[model samples]
Target: MQERIPRRTLLAGLGAGLVLPAAARAGDLAAAGWASARGGEGGRTLRVTTLAPDGPGSFRAAVEAAGPRKVVFDVVGVIDLGRKSIRIREPFLTVAGETAPSPGITFIRGGIQVESHDVVLRHLRVRAGRDGAPDRSGWEVDGITCWKAHDVIVDHCSIAWATDENLSASGPRFDGGDTVEAWRQGTSRRITFSNNIVSEGLSHASHVKGEHSKGTLIHDNATEVLIVGNLYAHNLERNQLFKGAVHAVSVNNLVYDPGTRAMHYALNAPEWEGRAWQVGQLALVGNVIKGGASTRPDLPFLIVEGQGDLDLYARDNRAAYADGRPMPELRVLPTTPLPKVRRLARPPLWPKGLKALPASAVEASVLATAGARPWDRDAIDLRVLRQVKDGTGRVIDDEKEVGGYPK
Candidate 1:
């Protein structure tokens, strides 16, 4: 006689523990942009019927023409561009390109700039294509940039290969000097950065540069950011730079093969500059950093190269070392403290619907969904898919290769 084991128990033991939390369902995910942007939900629909970069019925024209209307301009085909950047100065708008006929708009020499509040940009692909001139040319610029805008959301978009940063949120500021009541500058607020692929930036992956700088846009006061569920890869450094900001929450992001630095939270204000050196706030939670065997030690799981006074709080961050083992701790791997550190006592504000998935789950979810894509687009070319986790290539837009949501 043999003892029979229960089928349910056996099946449970065999499971690989791969599950998407019910709280993070697709319906909830779709509404995140609207919620974050204070109802930037793009009330009306303005279908873009062509691939023209910036003329009649084009993306730029529709957005510029849309006055006093909370409209969504849905792009239906891949729109190519030359030297002119698509600039938007309106409020309460949505630009959707998830259903483009081709891989979406490929920016050979231009990018986009949003300068208003309550805006949503979804499932669009803006890549500074590889070609003639050097990357130093200012014309080969950022994918999407915002200045002093608030309650904005960027989701499921793939932006890459920019001479500057792939994405930036900045505004203007004055260098506060010897005492006449120091005042704040044009600072952006309540901005959500999530569910996207930002990579191959020549200088930085994402630049949140604010304060007294030469940058066209500099937002120094009251900049609060919600950054989560994104994929950062193949960028040289500055995965996310907090040059001048007060609050930012970084969670559940997958950083695959970052170069010199994972993040730079600094007060770039020079010694002769303003009192802005004493401003910063950041929190790192549940982020997974997967580095190759060749990654340098200085660029560890995370690094701090800013003024020691920068307020930083880190927890539950995991890293895969060069030898392919989980890093035991998330301590600064340096031999000496760059400067006497300043750890924050208060934690960052967690958004309403953010769920903390495991490091593995987060990586998988980002890999499957981040970029000019849904969770179901992955029929990639061998040249691209081979380096999807590390190097840069033609990111395939085939939703068929992707599996179910967070499977």
Candidate 2:
């Protein structure tokens, strides 16, 4: 029973104020061969090796026969539901579920549910249905839901076991009284979860407590956002009650042995009304934080308790703290020194009466040497003059000779 039009009659049968040419804009190539010939008859564009034979309902009847617009799913391998069990039911839309309300794929129990929108699930490998669980209906419900999806891309996939957590959505479920019921709804914008490899569900593992899972970019989703090079060796109370609010950008990831004793970052907003923890721009760069001695003496690679203006940045890291304690004050910044004089707008190619030296004679030969300062402008790697500094060092004269010029 799915045929309810009238979103202005599906934008007037998609000819709503039309305009095409300039090679049919929208990622050109004649608008992707007119969206792969409206997605059928050797459908011109939906590669993943041109998947057919009815699955994802022949990719939702090849995106409603590619008529509407914007289709690009270049997933090169693994669309094997060999042990068949792929379900996506519900009002579904796609474009990443309408700008990103979360769910390129999801399935939460109770008579199974699924949704879609502006979809783009790349390099696919969606598993989770080896036939296990259903005494009261749980594991074995292959999921994928997306609402309000826009510009969504779950790239380079390998989404595993998934009793849960490849993509999530939340809001609603406090029924003691009052009027509210939102066990994860929508709102996702410009979403892009690149280089994926999500894992979970050894035996019914997909537990996500809610608070409207925030905007994410979760770069390199290490084992499904376990954080840093993914390493979860055994369920230590669901990896210490895994939480989320994530305004993410977490880089290089490698959260290895975090069974407990470490890993805690909370800012509870008492069910969203008090609404605290709002991390805007965070960029933890080049990570490699090793086990902090079983982790929980007071874990904090980062922990903000809400307010706003949270613009953090951590560079070239390599932390360690498994009870050998001594790594706090995680507010580092001081490693700037590398210039000495190297600015060439144009001038290079030796021997022809070579004479190209003046930036005030390389700043008076680096202020006459000796721990050269004067804001040591960096860039001078003149092979440290072949290191032969004996006669109490200090020599550059020859009229401040710089590129081949000492006759």
Candidate 3:
């Protein structure tokens, strides 16, 4: 249990920019990893009074309001987005979906896009389905994507049915300044995607690029990313892919039913045609990957592709088939082989207080704590978790296969 600190003292320390201790971090479950230090500490409260996609008291309205604020919900159930996303451009904001009623709040037909800094999002569910759009109609939506955003934490949310990557950190690969470090800083950095349930991304849906049932894409140049304690299920590929120049740590995640691919790294040559190549640095520790019905046979834990190089550190990552048979740890594409995918003796970067659970314990821990309102899970989330346990889910083309949206 978390010991309570006085509101006065907490605010005072926040104002003083004091790094919170582990006990203090426990007070707010959303505070963890690289993003644990700062967020909307002294913000005004903004209440979401309706489930409408947009209006005076809608979720969209509260997020778009000026200044630092913590958005709380007065209503629950789904917010039909009319197949359009809500863009959050303000800095120092907290969207506290856990403050809602028992069922909590859910967004359908669209998702949230974070384009600012110092943001904390928790306990929300974004079901960004195709919304009856024709296949290849270019209606790509992500279940909470951060673009060039920093000091952000997205925790315990349920994301599914996305046409594109479910939860991604993406931006201009090279921007801001002259040096490589400056370019990395210009994009999304210091972001945490933790304890979330990312599942059932729509395969052969409304994406313009054809089949794109992806999990999470840490885009090129994004840095200081921490992905821990999340459940990735029934996604076709990109079960969290790290592009070139990305520095990320993925630990203790439970991945199930990832078809053809589990975790991957790639750096497109055309995307960096004229510029110098940047190597991706990644550390995968204590993660559990179990193949399901949709998964192909003899798939390794990771597949590296594209033209750029990668420095990787993998430890205690367990991969198994549905029948409990072991699988390989790493496989590079034949096109990009050998030294292009270098194995690192030590981790490239490690967060200050990240405690990765053992691979054997990842499944139980994530199933119990991941996703929105785990104590009061929605029907869809419950079904997904059950299928994960039974090794019985598939990559679907539509949400209707899983009974569509919740009431």
- Tell me, by lDDT, which candidate is best: 3
Tens digits of per-residue lDDT, candidate 3, 246-310, equal 89999989999989889989887779756888888999999999999988898899988878899
Candidate 1 regions with alpha-carbon error over 4 angstroms: 1-43, 68-75, 99-107, 175-185, 203-222, 325-340, 344-346, 375-407
**Residue 207 miss distance in model 2 (angstroms):** 23
Candidate 2 residue lDDT tens string, 1-407 = 01122234322322322222322122111001001112112224432223343455344444444333333443322233333443332211222211111112221121111233334443233434323343224333322323333233443333333343333322122222332211112333333343333322233232233111111122111111212222222112122122323333343333322323222223234444543333333444444433422344544444333222334444554445554454452422222221112222322111122122222222122212111110111112112211211111112211122232111
Clashes of each: 8, 61, 0
Instruction: Give the Cα lDDT of each candidate.
Output: 0.54, 0.28, 0.84
Clashing pairs in 3: none
**Order by lDDT, highest first:** 3, 1, 2
Q: RMSD for all candidates, in order, please.
A: 8.8, 27.1, 7.1
Candidate 3 residue-pair clash tally: 0
Clashing pairs in 1: 171-217, 171-218, 171-219, 172-218, 376-399, 377-398, 377-399, 378-402
Q: What's the C-alpha lDDT at position 348 in model 2?
A: 19
Error of 2 at 3 (Å): 40
